[model samples]
Target: MITPRFSCSQNEESVVVKIYCPSVRASDIEINVDDTLFTVHINPYYLRLNFSQSLLEDDESSAQYDPSSGYLTVTLTKAEKGQVFKDLDLLSKLLAPRLTEPPPGNPIIEVLDSDDAADIQTDEDALVQATESLTLEQNEILEAAESDWQLKQEVPEPLSSLRTSPTDRYGFLDSYSGYFTHVEHTENEVNELGSEAETLPKSDRRKHRIEHEEKKWDEEYYLADYADGEHIQELLCWRHPHLQLPDVSYTPEEELAMLNLPRKEYLASPLQTRQLYLTLLTLLFAYAYESRTTQHDPTPESGWTLGILIPAFSALDPPPYTDKSTNDPSTFSIEEVISTFVASYRRSLAFPLYRSFALAESCRSDVASFLSKGRRMVLRCLLEMKYILDHHDVYYVYSKIWIDDFCVWIQANASDETLHQLGSLICSLKIPKADIGWDLEELEALVSNSEVGREADSDDESEDEVERMLPTPL
Candidate 1:
């Protein structure tokens, strides 16, 4: 009888074995030793033995042949004292009996009706418990989600809070507690540092250094005495003669002649003119504040001495004429005249300091009446300054000084008519236009319809109108 014959073949990466027998059909199998043993448990399984060992004596390198699925294999590379064919034959014989007999202690399935019922009951209870727990967890998660949504909607929290907020529904309290603890620890550290801070005296090195630096700056930048209008007038009187006042008995013609001195002779000095302007402005402010009558003697110490100088100087040194003539010689526009005067004044002085004094004076209560009267001559001077600044793109600086002073006066005694006139004047600038429509109207209405100014019609006038139009009873 031809017993089953086994043979082995080798590939580059794996080994293959063939099993043949008179009773069994030929079968081919392949395996690798590095592969899991569980992989060889398949039907018609094969073993892969290392072929690097020499076949000489029995050693640890020689492994026993065991085929999990009725197949046998022996590696020629790992054979010891046996030929490849003999090793295969030995492996086949060793595995044949093991394959023919049933495996020992095979798993048995027992049917225990009573015990199965109990286990089923237990499993059902566990499932129900798990479901209940899951439902509770889901409800908790939903409630937490709603609460978080509400919090986000109600409060504007920082992004940092959002980043540190717990994402896991169950871990919210723990995360919040940890965050608070961390904050407390940080606060404690800050408090400890604050408590330990030293109370340094002014004599301390750092304090001394700061004090020294402040003292150095104070000494370096000491402010000089401000030159007042009176001082400037004195300086002018000392420097120029035509600017000097003759005896009060002089007639108006004599005074006018003195004022009309040639510009090249008496008004040649720009500095004297600026000083005179400042003195005139100061006097105007004093007179306005005192509410003095305009009809006062021109040569009074407190009257024309300061106020007449400006007009006299202007007459002596008239501004250079421009090609643009006044629209109406009899009643020149106040806005145009003021603009011309300011522009001429600025050009003549070549400095903003003196210009600011002139503007401030014009906005004062006394001279403010002049602006209020809408006089073409005075208004021309003010508008001239404004025009120069607007044309040169320096209106920001000019407006800062002019508008602030003007607003102060306006606030004290502003009228609807004044606001309307102001709006019209500002609108004429064309550049950097002012938004005066609603604002001006509102300011005007506030003053015009005030409760204190409102009054009921007289009884006699009311009766006379009533008799004129008696309505027939309906």
Candidate 2:
């Protein structure tokens, strides 16, 4: 049977298998389930998976096909809950190659040209002698042998997998982990084997060799925390292209570009207020993109977080509360703003706390202490999610509760300048009136009790000082 292009993921109780077979149909599909065994057949291709030793419960399996997506999902109930499967796509294991041993013999070897044959006179004499005596078949064989050696050389076979031990099986994670490890290495290559390694014991040297080889294999791969902007464009912004900010592909640049204001030419014909909100959307996701556990570190490729790049709070404040001045909604609500934050937070975090921590710790040598630390920070970020849903409430939370604690919390992990930018960014976001409306009077009242309101109205000389004191992540 032909191989199937498929992927598998799991929840607490079931394994979901998604097979990509765009040309297949429900009429051609077949599934057989037994208590520990599962089988899926689509015409000429079929998969038989025995999960007796796995977490699978082996009963009440189910399948569904989405014709539009051309994918079939099969759900297999799990015997055990909360047990993580290191792998679920066992097709590769079942399909381990059955290699036939080569016949025992010393294979014939090709010889280099004899010194006498290299000479024109000797070669001409030999050719003439062969033409005079040998049959056409014999001459053809000789001529073919002579010509084969002179043709373009064949490429040598690639080296085998870099896996050094049985436990070090190869997979996508292995490749990506190796890349992150390579990027972290900053020592002089010469020095690694020079005076420093010379002093180490034999065991240390062997370990070093293993690490070097692993890095060699993974140096070509890079894993990202989120899918591209194109992934969700249809879901969120089919018509609103400006709202669909593209996820960053690999590059020499940091995430600051995503958060920064769009250039003048990039903003099409839109009201000033709309431009302000759209630019705010860019900053929100940009902040989310950079929130990865490793992004705070200063690397050669992407240096320190460029917090000081954002305009100061005073500069971002909308012109003195006016409905006539700007076509921005008269009433602003915070529901959409909070929803956006929640969505972005989830996108940035990518996985549940437990799952994320597990992935981080696993990817760490294969990402290690650095990645582990990053996940811990992510845990803290999860706590910040609760207070970020509504504007009026966010302003109050920031002014009263969060400013006092969350500001310091972020400062511990990021630069002081970054903390200020985050504060400004949250304050800068204003959800335009969609359905329900609140006027400037209500907007002022929503923030009136908070320090953000005070700082927004402060004199330029005192603005800087007051802005520093306005810590309301509460």
Candidate 3:
């Protein structure tokens, strides 16, 4: 079955989907609308979409086909009139299904009642009670300390609240709770650590380290290391030549056509999923690097680059992993996940940091090299994936299948030697002078002069001190 090309537009009361199916019979077209889902079937051409808001097949809803134009126009009424609909133009999101479960380890709140008497209590009442109780407690503490003008000391608890035993053995909930106990750290660093990190698996610790390192590089670092060079030639050689070539920018009509292209999800194995994510990281980094080097600026949105990377509309081509027995009509594919990684990164809070020099440097060689090395090297790419995954998006399924499994497998099977080799390899990687974009000789001379000046000042201070000590007799 062929999934037809389509486009969506919405007003306050209705959404219009225009599907392109050439030489189709109008009477043969069958349509189904169930709450948020909409499906269309006409012999060989099929299209399925899941909308954010529910749709109603009321009098306002209608379907029409223009045989000459090869367009099937289906109008869907909004469940609530005047309610605004969003993402009508984001066709990939519309094609993907909504998440069925909360992410692992999150609390699931069950709303048992909407209008019960217990639900009527306001926040102001709770705040007033809390304030009164705090005041009484403070009064008592002041009275006790009044005699000596100092509070009495008490014995420390045997264990910290943070160090209390975890409720689960998987350690996803409290993986890092015991980190400080076994390892020494400054009080402030320990205090700065947030509770949320402990809820994630231990494999994410490397991601946190990568984030921390990137934070240390500011505008000065970017200017010093990446912005000052003649980078276009290097970028062209480093990435694809096609990236440097100018192509006609997509018009609104063309963009809508690309957005609505028919696609399908692949039944990928765990190994294939891992390979897919690794490839995604490589592509995203290459895109970011190419943008920075050629454009001399970070790309705010990366979805447009997909056209240059892949042949136009080839993303919707039938994938190799299609299963005939369990095939579903939803238009999705591995390419869509790749596209989602780029789109999700744009939506992330850390999008601005997408082109950090540290990230590019890490991916410089390892992007392709890490693929053959299996889980250990793939973990490095996962650090990149961590930034792009954001909170929730299409890649969440891959996360559940591959990322979570890798985390568990690594926790059980990873040895100290593997970690040592990873660290050693990271340290061995050298940054070329051209890559740094800094004049090494000039920077070194400036540093040397500054140090010499500091030494002379120190000598003068010592001479003055000696003079002051001897001159008192005169």
Q: Using lDDT, give the best candidate's number.
A: 3
Total clashes for model 2: 17
- From the highest lDDT down, the ranking of the candidates is 3, 2, 1
TM per model? 0.17, 0.22, 0.35
Misplaced by over 4 Å in model 3 are 101-285, 295-474
TM-score of 1: 0.17
What C-alpha lDDT values do all the predictions have?
Answer: 0.30, 0.36, 0.47
Instruction: Between candidates 2 and 3, name the one with more favorable TM-score.
Output: 3
At residue 286, candidate 1 shows an lDDT of: 32
Which one wins by lDDT: 1 or 3? Answer: 3
Query: lDDT of model 1 at residue 133?
Result: 71
Worst 10 residues of 3 by lDDT: 310-319
Give the Cα-based TM-score of candidate 2 against the true structure: 0.22
TM-score of 3: 0.35
Query: Between prediction 1 and prediction 2, which has the larger TM-score?
Result: 2
